[model samples]
Target: MYIGLLSYSLAAIFFLVLLGVLLTDRRQDKPSRKYLLLATSISILWAGMAAFQSGKIELLFIYQTLEVLRNLFWQQFLLLVLGRSICAEDQSPIIYRAKILLYIISALMVVLIIDRHLLQFIPVLAHYIDPLLVGYLVQAVAVLVLLEQMLRNTRKDMVWAVKFFCLGLGGIYAYDFYLYSEAMLFQHVDNMLWQSRGLINALMVPVIGVAISRHPEWSSGIFLSRRVVFHTTTLLGGGIYLLVIGFGGYYVRNFGGGWGVIAQTLFMFGAIIILALILFSETLRAKLRVLINKHFFHYKYDYRDEWLRFIYVLSSFDETIPLPTRSIQAIAQIIESPGGMLWMKRDNNIYLPVARWHMAAVYDSENADTDFIKFMEEHDWVINLDEFEWNPGVYRSRGFFSLPDWLRSMQNAWLVMPLILQDKMLGFVVLTHAKNRRHNFNWEDTDLLKIACRQAASYLAQHEAAQALSEVRRFDDFNRLSTYMVHDLKNMIAQLSLIVSNAAKHKNNPLFVDDVVSTVENSVTKMNRLLSNLKDDVRGSEDKEDIDICCLIRREVDNRKRAGNTPNIELICVDEKIISTANHDRLASVISHIIQNAQDATPVSGNITIKLHKHINHAIIEIEDTGCGMDESFISTRLFRPFETTKGKSGMGIGVFEAREFLQRLGGDIEVESEMGKGTLFRLHLPLSRVK
Candidate 1:
């Protein structure tokens, strides 16, 4: 095989760049800096191999030692990277020791590959037993683990650039793993796999450049198209292989060999990872949300359907119902919070846990105590576990959790956010300590937590309003039913009065005329007044007109006399031509009803007096009677409700109700002030207009 000189040159250049990356990372934290150094060391070994492959063996034994050390550094690098990714920062010493073990293993492997006597394995250069093959395999796996961690920690609403760096670098590492594993284990390398690895390297150049330059969040939309092509090709390659296995099995049975097995394996693994990334991409999720909103009416406000459920839960005090935790957990996972609990205030004083989902059963309502309440009251903000200090008084005084018990459990809590509504403290949420992380929560995590908390609060508020609305609707229904029965009864009474009056008109020809006329007049008058008021009550308004006060007073007096009134109807008018704006039909009905009630209350011959006076902008009509007046209880409860009456024979209970309703519509009011024994005075206050 004619190994290209270009490969060696490129490898040497990358080795130098790795060294530069390591040198620049001197001031960085141990594990990250150490990993870079280890990567650099490994690059040096590969450079040695590259030089040796160019037919130079100046320090073959020394190069072998360096290769062994490089291999050992790689194991440490992988452990450190994985440990850091999982936030086991303090555990790197253990991993560093693991690297020492790998170094010894590498030395043994080197002796075996070079001498062929250690494990009966021959060292093959750029062939089946190449040391670089395993190195690439380990790197590829490390890259995949790093990518997974990056994706897990990424904020859903983060800018595209951070995501680009994460996915691009991740995708590259994954591709490199497949290519390295395939090339090293097999006799020949597939051109497709080789090209894919090259593409990954090409994609990684920009990512590494940006990451090193501290532009981790820069969007790489330019590469998105390229990635789509790469994924699509992976999918196609998988499909072709599957089709070959399913439909071309006869051809495979005759021609299948190592090449066929390798092809199928690569296609299957590549297709799965690529398709999984595409499907799980945040961009894809966002697009799905938009699609749901456009195509599905039920998911309009929230594409995830959580908002609607949150609304339903909020409007009621029914905390027994459960809510879906998927969206909340998804959000929490995105923000790197291992455990989350959402609390809502019920009835202002009591707090209830509405939702609780965690990576473990680390928190429960048992931890909710008086201290938690006080802590929420004192500091109504999001508390990040990374920044929070242990204080017994904070949660203990409020009875949230016992400090001793909490400490003994080795449970670490990182963030607590208060759910606030309109400046009133509602409740608070707590996030368990993040796993494998010591870096204080990032801004993206905080922002996302804030958003989720805000969303939960909004849902609670909406649900509460909905519950109240339902109650109001129930009250409205009750009022409607009561109103209907009263209205119908009033109409029936009116009809009975009419029938009595008709019989009275024909009484003289049949039987006792005086008794009949009196009975009919009393019934008819009572019924007529009740029905008129009922009509006003039903309409909820009155007909408006300007009426002459003197005329109305005289008419009332004459009517009383015509009805054989025992007590005289007295009239005192200050202004003869004083006119008042009123509903004439309603006012006449009100005046007649009042006079008749007054007359009934008076002794047979006791006097009833009416006075009409004009005050500034008001026509004060007063009717006084020496009748049995109302008590406090009568006036308070029974005066306004429809169908309440004092008179035994003619009281239909609609008079005052109608009178109040009519006067209200005419911009006036009727007031009654009466003692239990003294005469009653009914005063009608009407807005008066000066006569033209």
Candidate 2:
């Protein structure tokens, strides 16, 4: 008996539909249509084989030849399906070799038929045809393996399509296996069962068609569309219903043994699922979308799992440890973007792509044009998706189009966000798509993109700040070096001052040995004090030591008197050996410097007094002189800084600065009470621990 005319007609219509789709899409060089061509061509051959199953000898020969050709293309078709669906790599060599072998085998098979030689592989028995037995087992196994490989080899983002494609093939294979087994074992296969298999196979064409056609061209519009949700709900609901009913029937035949109660229970469950699906179609569609978004397309989310993960990474950062390249790649993977690169502004004119994650080669165009630089200068953050026409808010937006060669490419067009710390822009992050044309970024993706950008920005800002601190530290070292050189020079000047003083005293009295000895002795004392001061200024100390206030004052005043023509000096110490807690060498140097200033300011007979007073917490030594005093403006601004002194010829300007610093190290302070043209009083407040 011929297969029912209706099955043949429906199969013919499906074949024509697939053929038309293939021809139209293939004209446009669309790769998606190849799947349709293979499925349709195999189906048409199956229909023809079914039609001519019980015909005459001559007609049987023709139909059998067609079956051989069908088998040949079936193998080729499986290779194409797996290659396209799996790695996205073209492996047409498999098909080419299969076709060549098929031609040689077919010619041999034709000669066997004519000469009555053995071709025992044929399933047609003498009594009745085995009804798809020869074709079903081989094709089913081949296609099943192909689908399995496709599911296994594809990337995670494309795995859903691979899974659906496998399931579709599996569904068809199940039906084919059932009918083929029944025909071989029971010697009869139900027409209804075979027809159901064909219809199921037809359903898969649309599914697999959608998988190949719609995939790899993802748009925000498609994901956000209501129709996509509606279709998904309908398809998934129908699939579950069929799955339940099919498995339920199978269970009744096997485990249930066709039990009435088991059948009824299974039927009820299927009906309930179907009824609920129909009743709440709109709600179910919306629910399906929510499920998909929650599970897969959550990259564009504001408060998604991706957002939380990104924030968690940002918050738990170790600034000392470097960020991994995989971290940036994870951002791109999460968002389904083509590539991403993190950029930081190193200085005014240069931006560097420090970290990169991409499937393709990343472009590193260091020097952007003046306008591009100016754009970054003007705004802390920027994003250009090649569709910069949409950004009406950007002034001089034409600069985006004027980027360097590699940057002008769509791969470099990015969504950039500036990382700011303390209202200052530190760096920018960029996400781009040039290789994979699918732009999976949505509004939710943009939100997550911002989150990724923010996380990257924070890390980059920290790194840049650390780098700045390193530079400042180097500058400080250089400044300290300059200070050391000047300190050594001051020691040499002190020694030279002594030599000049001694020489001046003995200039007219060569035989006055007494005068020479006293003068030389005073010079040696001054030199010892100056050398000690020089050592204390260069290498600092924190220890508190004993200080002789009267002795230190007398030594400093004598040095001033010997060096200059002024001579009215008196030392009035309440404690002749007043000791205090201080770095004694540093304190003595400060005392001497203060006295020299007083002596310089004193007139020809002006009084210079060094008075020491001991308080409960500190010992105060006041050096008063009738000489020029300091103004409030000069004292406040220039007192502690270098190159800030009143005396023109005698001062190196760092004396007061170094003196104040020395006193501070000893846990003490220096205070000044002065009037312009009147003598200045320098008071040293030394901590009591420095007393000896």
Candidate 3:
């Protein structure tokens, strides 16, 4: 088939398809769609006429008629798409006047075609003027106007959608204008240009189709389909394949001496196979998809999918995986980064590398410079190292500190995203070059990284908070155990003090010597218990057992009386055994502490009473002292607090706190009532153990 015939047939088919698409569209009522359909229909008619021109005067007239109509429709389409009005009420004066002038030109072209005498009337141009040339000039003007309108109306985001339309239509009109201007000057069209017109028109069909496919509102629901991409790639690849084969054949035919034909044939077949393999490769296809989406599409990511994956990575509770590593991995995945290192600020104002993902080159002790940290803290910028290096002046002008040599030396460092929480920079992560090298850090990338970094910072902060809390709890436990040991030591010292006081009088008594021996033995046992509690590996468990509360109280009272203190100490209790489940030594120690406190608080003339009784399911012990009584504020506020005291340097305030804690551990509690200048009452309640 002849090239001209093939080109014209393709052009006709393309326009018909466009016409059908517009007619079937649900939004044909839209002025733009309506004008587009009209323009396409007229274009089809013009191409059909031009296909059979064959130098016939009538056919030439028909072609020029359709050209005039096609130009008019194109003008209307351009105007409507550009948001210009042609209606009488809303039309601007320039547009209204231009429309009227177009109609006048169309009428004049028809008159000139009907009568050759009309050109003769313009005496100076009678021989030079041609109606076809005049019609082409009008079409060129209309196309130029359309191009200008498109340029003025298009936005950055809309450029892709309108670019093909402007290029295709503008090429057609520009060629026509050149051909007609040459014809008007030389009295004939160039044969080569005239012949190529059909092929050029056919080539423009695909470009126009792309423009329509990318129409924002018209193709809103239809994304860049996979099939469209596959076919477009195939077409482009086929063109390149043909060009390569043609070049190789020319080389073989001219340069290959005797084996030219054979070599040419082999080379052609091999090239075909190689090209086919490249087109079919999955890796190549994936790369192509990424490239097209990155360059052609407005958005680089499916935000919903990206957000869900990010959330999953951060929220994962795998104990073996550290949170800092997970945080780095989560953000790195967004940009297909191969490796990253997370740096966190320490208490000493140093940022140290704490976690790394697939990052073997980075050292654990890597620290960010104080100047760099200060700059990031103040600006909170996502530093793209490429930009920082390439355009250092831009950063320097904005008051950014110079990039550290250590950081710039890292070969793969692409971006540094600051992890800021609550207006403070916690740290930053340094990401290596993206796995997909084509992807660049843009505004969207920076925004997403900042948001993800905040979430990660929260996780890091929470992890740090938990660690600090755990340490605090450990110290609190050790301090508490130490306080109990000191209170016990205080009791032991008091016991020995009484022994020393009565040593001279009772030194010769055998019974008193036995009592002193028992007291010394008990003190040694208590010291060993205190030492055992201090060992880190040994945790003290309460030795809970049934105890005779009545005998316990009587023994404590007798020991105090033997101490020879001036205050009169008395025990009041039922003779019956009062048994309760409790730790024996802890219970004894607590009771002794209370009795000692009462003795110390009371004056020599004051009386200290100890009372024990079983009430319902509980045993109650009350110690009343007629000494310096506590005020309500002191009892409520300072009482039971470890290290707090009213007895000057002689008192270790842990006694009452330890007493209350031990009692509460055995389902018991202590209550105190006091009045200033009167006396103080202490009550201890313990759950009674059922008799077995």
For TM-score, the strongest prediction is 3
Residue 514 alpha-carbon offset, candidate 1, angstroms: 19
Q: Per-candidate TM vs. native?
A: 0.30, 0.41, 0.47
| Every candidate's lDDT | 0.57, 0.59, 0.77
Best by lDDT: 3
lDDT of 1 by residue, 392-474 (tens): 33344444543224323545566667666666656666566666554634433454455666666666566557656864675
Give the runs in model 2 whose Cα sits over 4 Å from its true position. 1-21, 26-38, 41-72, 80-97, 100-132, 146-164, 214-287, 290-444, 447-455, 458-462, 465-469, 475-479, 482-486, 489-493, 496-692
Candidate with better TM-score, 1 vs 2: 2
What's the TM for model 1? 0.30
Between 1 and 3, whose TM-score is larger?
3
lDDT digits (tens) for residues 1-692 of candidate 2? 44444555565566666556555532434433454465467677666455445334566555555545554454555565556554433556764575565556656555554554354555355246542354545555555666566667667867755555566656767666677677777677576786565456566655554444334432112232445645665677777877787676666656655486677576767677776766576545545666655433423343557666665655555644235343465566555557666655644345655556553434353543345555654554455544454543343443444444555554455665555455444555566654553354334454455556556656656655775686567557647865875775577567556657767666677575555576567667765665553333434375665656667677776776787646477888887656665665666667766666676677777888888888787788888888878864466435655655676644546678777767776667677767788877888877775322
How many angstroms is residue 58 displaced in model 1 relative to the true structure, after the best TM-score fit? 2.4
